[model samples]
Target chain A: MSWADTILQGVLLGGLYALFAAGLSLVFGIMRLVNLAHGDLIVLAAYLILVLVSGLGLHPFLAVLIAMPLMFGIGWLLQAYVLNRTLGPDILPPLLVTFGLSVVLQNGLLQAYSADSRRIPSGSLETASVALGPFNVGVMPMLTFASAVAVILILNRVLYGTELGRAFRATSDDAVTAGLMGIRPNRTFAVATGIAMAIVAIAAVFLGTRANFDPTIGPARLIYAFEAVIMGGLGSLWGTLAGGVVLGVAQTIGGAVNPEWQILAGHIAFVLVLLVRPRGFFPRAVD
Target chain B: MHGRTIPWRVETRTKASTVFAVLAAMIIVVGVVAPAYLPRATLQDLFFILTMLVLAQSWNLLAGYAGLVSVGQQAFVGLGAYAMFAGVVLLKLDPLVAILLGGAAAALLAIPAGFFAFRLQGAYFAIGTWVVAEIVRLLIAQWKTLGGGTGTSLPGAATRAMFGTDLVQRLMGVRPAQAVDIICYWLALLLAVATIFTVYRLLRSRHGLALASVRDNQEAARAVGIDARRLKAMVYLTSAALTGLVGALIYVQKARISPDAAFSVIDWTAYVIFIVVIGGIGTIEGPIVGVLIFFALQKLLADFGSLYLLALGLIGIVIMLFAPQGLWGLFASRTGIQLLPVRRLLRGGSLDT
Candidate 1:
């Protein structure tokens, strides 16, 4: 393929990565809680979508729509019951708790699904493609990119244009002061996690349709998502998108040179970014 | 006034510690002589415990004491192992000497890693360290000489000719393999004891106070003229070196090395984190108690496979939620006893006098 085509493919692949990162970025921005299980949760959502598609005989898109609310509920309960308890001055609790959660989720998934790789069978759309000025792109990739844009746009709106957004910002800035203002930082946190999980559902649909996923693939996806978040800077959704694109481009270019270097190249790019701009490209004013 | 005795004195070694020191010496004596009476299987198990203790102590020093909270310690472990392998397979050095090389290599890697990761704070720092580990794993996999993705094994000649194995064999009247196991076990025991002793000493020193202050509040620690960054970096480098030694020794005992196994985040980082967290982070005795419990759980849950991991995860979460200071922390608080107390107590003082 031509260089432009390769670059374009990388940009499209980045959409999937950005989708993975959006939820993590949201949670970290709101609570400063780095959920190590964020990737496992995405995988869990993918499994939920898979079951809906196969067992219920629903379309993959419809399966995602159903899974989103269910995932939101799980996220809500998890935050309220499990994660909120770990928040405090000590960083060890939240980190260890989430790491433990990651292990549990992975092992639990292994017991439930075996080690087999599963992909959501999105027939016809998987093979369909659209030509854009001497380049052919899969219809699914285009849709994925479009959906990623839509998710970010909607999240931006919810974060900036709504009363809920104000509460989120208030709680993030000063949880104690926000608590004094009757904002109920814990409840706001639960809501934010729920929304993040809902986004995970959307990302899951794309993830399941695009490739074969097994129980252990979660951590790799997490690293990709994390790299994007770091590159983009914390608390900036648009920067996350750009970070994903940069990572995707690096991987594709590396793959073009040597297939083995693909993942390495992306990681190298992340480290280089860290070396240059430690806070990332678009750090927030406060933290 | 000149003859009056000093009214107060500061002391770090409590009565409990004084008694515990005798108990520890007895335990070390038993550990050293265990091979003669114990079976090879039991020896291997002891080896596992000792190495894990070393790793847990190193991690505790980093996260519990220095406030680093790294999740990428496997990087150092893997580097140490690979460096040892290179030393043995390519450089034709003794495995014992290579172990030291492993520690040096890991410490060297820490310089750049710490420089990069220190830029991030708290949770971000944790992920940054993990990223560095991932990078290291991928890069090591490219080292085709050391078996690349598939990994390599130590030659029989290297294993058979390892220093002190023959002496162990002659002294114990065991086969070469068993002697090697004994050697590794002794080395592991030595390292574990050294790690614990060194940590205890460090925690008792003025630098330990600096580390505690840094963990409590970095800005406050900095404002007090404690070079928090330098202190943290020193701790990071020290932890990396110790972890590297443990890793090299572990791989030596296993007699095989692979990128995947060596760099596994779960085995090297996650489990160590769990051990430290569940035991009582920031305490010397916590890891000792935690490692014992962890070993017992593994034996009990051996048949459950993935369920074993799931249970461990659940237990870790539960401990973090209800008892953040860990089981040892709980015990220490309720009993008001410290077997290895590092806190300075002002005793034998009365204002009325």
Candidate 2:
């Protein structure tokens, strides 16, 4: 394909990555808790969607809608019961706990699903395409890109335009002070994680439909999401989308040069971005 | 009352430490002579334990002491193994010498890695290190000479002719394969003992105080004129070197090298993290206790496949939640005993009396 076409494809692929990163960025921004199992959670959501589609004979879109609330509940319970206990001055506990959770989730998925790669069968939508300017783009990619935009827009609204957003900001800024203000930091954190998981469900719809996924693919996705968050700068939602595009472009260009260099190129781009702009492209004022 | 002198001395060694020291020496003696009486299978298991102990100790020093909290240690392990492979395959060096080269290479890798990682803090630093490791693994996989993504094995001839294999064969009256295992086992034991002793000594030194201070509160440590960054870098480099050496030794034992196996976060970092966390993160005895328990668990859960890892993860989470200090920490607190005491006690003071 032409260079423009490749770049366009990369930008579309980035939507998927941004979708992957949105939940992680949200959690990290709100609580400074890096959920290591984030990628697995996305995969878990994808599997949930898969079961809904394959087992329950629901449409892929409908499956995601059902999965979102269920995922939100899981995230809520996980934060309230497991994760909140790990938060403290010591960084080791939260990190180790999350890392352990990542392992458990991956292994659990493996035991449940075997090692087989699964993809949500989206039928003709998977093959349908739309012409944009001189290039043809898959309808699914366009939808994914649109959904990513929608997710970020909605999250931004949730984070900025809502009363809960104020509480989130307050708790993020100073949990102790926020607690003193009767903001209920723990409950706010639960809501925030729940929302993040809900985003994971949306991301899962695109992820499961777009490509093949298996149990062990989570860490790589986590890395991609992490790279996007780092590149976008912490706490900047729009910047995450930009970071994902950059990474996606890098991978596509690298793949054009050599298929093997695709993933490596994205990682190299992240490291380079880190070298030049360690705080990322759009760092928050306080952080 | 004329010219009365204060009668007190600061001491790090305690009665328990003294007894533990004797016990440690006895264990070392037994370990050194184990190959003669033990079967090859048992020797291999001992080798695994020794190498893992070294890894756990290195990680503990980095995370528990220096507060680096890296999740990318597989970078050092993988690089160390690859460097050793290059040495043996291309440079025609003895595997023993290549092991040192591996350590050097890993330490070298740590310099740039530290530069990048130190820019991030806490949890971000952990992810940064992991990214560096992923980058390294990806790059190493592209090195076509090393069999690329598929990985390569040490030539049987080279392994057979490895410097001390013949001597081990003669001394132990075993086949060349068994001899290689014995040599690697001895090397692993030596490295483990060296790692533990070095860590113990370092903790007893002034640097140990600096490390503790940095971990507890970096700002206060800096206010006191401690170069927190420099101290952390030193710990990082040392941990990388030691872990790299252990990695090289491990690959040498396996006689084969694969990128996935070598660079595995689960095998190298996650397991080591679990071991350190389970044993007691900051204490010297924690990894020792942790490795034994880990080994026992592995033996018991060996047949369960994914369940083994799932169990380990669950156990790790439980420990982090309920016993953050680990089993050793819990024991130490309850008993008020430190077998390898690094805490200075102002003993025999008039105030104490």
Docking class of 1: high
Q: How close is chain B to the truth by TM-score, in each candidate?
A: 0.97, 0.97
Model 1 C-alpha RMSD vs. true structure (Å) is: 1.7
Tens digits of per-residue lDDT for model 2, B214-237: 877889999999999899899999
Cα shift from native, residue B345, model 2 (Å): 1.5
Off by over 4 Å in 2: B1-5
Q: In candidate 1, what are the lDDT values of residues B261-308, reduced to their tens digit?
A: 999998999889888888998899999999999999999997998999
- TM-score of every candidate: 0.98, 0.98
Write down the worst ten-residue block by lDDT for model 1 chain A: A278-287
Q: Which candidate has the highest lDDT of all?
A: 2
Encode model 1's per-residue lDDT on A1-287: one tens digit a residue: 89999999999999999999999999999998999999999999999999999999999999999999999999999999999988877777888899999999999999999989999999898889988889999999889889989999999999999999989988999999999988998899999999999999999999999999999888888889999998999999998998999999999999999998999999999989988888789987345
Clashing pairs in 1: none
